[model samples]
Target: MAEQHAAGAEGIHPTNDPGTPGGSVDPQSGADSAAPTRRARRGGSRKSQKATGGWGAVREIAIVVVLALLIAFVAKTFLIRGYYIPSGSMEQTLELDDRIFVNVLGARTGHIDRGDIVVFDDTQGWLPEAPAARTNPVRQGLEFVGLLPDSSQQALVKRVIGVGGDHVTCCDASGKVSVNGKALDEPYLYPGAAPSDFPFDVTVPEGKFFVLGDHRNASADSRYHIETGTQFVSEQDVVGTAFVTAWPLDRFRFLHNPEDVFADVPAPARP
Candidate 1:
């Protein structure tokens, strides 16, 4: 009886033991069953992250674009503006269609001076009436941001020959223009173009400027308009001084004021 009981006990195995051949179940075996489910969940999570990342990238792109346009708008509004040369009045120095940057801040702050090339409004009716312009929305928007040139024809560009109370006279004895009794050797005059085809003597009124084009013969600037009483451009009408030629890559250069031309000219005598 003892032998029979011992053999029966040895054959029996705990139901939860994994090492026994006849065990009912093992806790470690459940891990293998759950692995596929965990793997599937991990794959699903990776896909969700990838989808979210795509939208995040688009949001980043949108932010960059908005920031760029805002910067352009701000810079264009208060700092500088762009304009294209529409005529040959300023030729050689600025060709037709040459894009330029104007210093709006300087003009607004009354930083104007003699020998500076400037753009001014046609408030005195210097330009003939222009037909209404047909504008493209895209082009207009670009112009607003200063990415495209300003196409308005109501402005003119010329060098400031006389400012405020200066006495400006043309064709002194040696065929040169004089300012405040000092002879002007204008090397920037268009080849073979006389300083003035006709004589002119005028004292620029206070808060005004006497302007002239480099192409003297072809331009009807302050010189030609003197008799009409529209010769002087009001300081309030000036848009800005052109600081640089910005487009047509090869022509890019700083448009500096003619320092030497006005250097020795004496200031207007006090009244």
Candidate 2:
């Protein structure tokens, strides 16, 4: 009997073992016996990595754009600025639709002198309330970013004729404007245009300037503003001196102030 029992145990099939491959199982069980497939896990990992890389590229591009915009903003606000000439007020020297660059830094450090072509705000109600120009969203964005000139601001450009307590008179016998009792040799005046169509003598007040345009006939400058009780522009209202013509590459040139024009004019008489 002992021999028979030992023989029976040794004869048992290996398939009956639960730990062996192809072992018998309970088919009604709900749980899955196999772990996840390697191929599925690898595919999921690749998708996750690709998604992360795409976002990283987008983040880097955004940072670069922001930095560029900041630099442009600071430059426009403090270092330099651009202006568009909408009218022929500064014609021959700066024509209609001409673009110019102003030296804001020079204005901050140096002084506004006679014969300087300057850009000034329309403070003291010098300009009438004109309708704003229509601009699309893209143009507006470009202007704000300093890539385009801001034409919406009511600014004027003219040469400084006299400054601060100087006596200025128009048509001093020789058809030339005189400053501080001395006549100016204005070669930049428009061809065949008289020094003044009307005669006037006035002393520029302290902290103000008398400005005139090269296109004398077309410009409604200080000569016209006298009746408005604001004949001169405040020194503080000056945005900057225009130093260069930037647009229309064929017309590019430095806007040099003819210092010798004012060389002989005597200083303003002492108070």
Candidate 3:
């Protein structure tokens, strides 16, 4: 008997053929499919990275621009400013070359007291012949930004002598101007000028102010209007007080409201 062949000798019963997968694809196609899937995943990752990098650059540029704008706005609003003197009105105290800085917040916050030098609008005709006197809408707008030169029309700076109702009589027996019956010893008065040469006896009206120049002889201030009995500047006309001589390092100085005088004076009675 020829070594009896095994009954089911076809070997293992033909496995479910993982390579054929229900007669769909061949073995090589399976390998080809995996290659494309990996390539597509890599391409998507590279595109995502590029998009992220582009947006990052844009965000950086936007941040820089925003910072620059913020800095400019802050400087314009609350920091150092420049102004030009338009006339001889505030001479000796503020000359033509003098560029000054004003403490606007202080003035608004009641830091401006008597004898504090101030800059304001001359719309009330304080300096009738000032170059900035006529139709100066452009100059007036620049005044708000502090960009215009000092000589701009419709602006002036003076000393606060009388606020509200105070008998602001001039040329007292001592040649001193009296406020509410007390005489002010003005040391800042210009040499050769005695308080005021032209006599004024009017009591400053309520809600109005009496301002004069440090250089009374040259200034056409309230005294000029008083001499003519024409126009007087009201307190509302005050823009803000000048507190510093900012430019020309040689002339740099801080202004103080003569402590010795205002200290003795009493507060004004409420109306």
- Cα RMSD to native, each candidate? 10.4, 10.3, 12.4
What TM-score does each of the candidates earn? Answer: 0.78, 0.78, 0.65
Alpha carbon lDDT of each predicted model: 0.85, 0.83, 0.67
- What tens-digit string does per-residue lDDT give for candidate 2 at 140-227? 9878978776657678899999999899998888988999999988888888888789988889898889999999999999999887
Task: Tell me the tens digit of each residue's lDDT in model 1 across 210-262.
Answer: 99999888888998888899999999899899999999999999998888988
Evaluated against the true structure, the overall lDDT of model 2 is: 0.83
lDDT by residue for model 3 (189-215), tens: 766677887777767676666888878
Q: After superposition, how far is residue 219 of candidate 3 from its true place, in Å?
A: 0.5
Better of 1 and 3 by lDDT: 1
Candidate 3 is scored at a TM of: 0.65
Candidate 2 TM-score to native: 0.78
The parts of candidate 2 lying over 4 Å away from their true place are 1-48, 132-152
Worst 10 residues of 1 by lDDT: 17-26
Clash count, one per candidate: 0, 0, 6
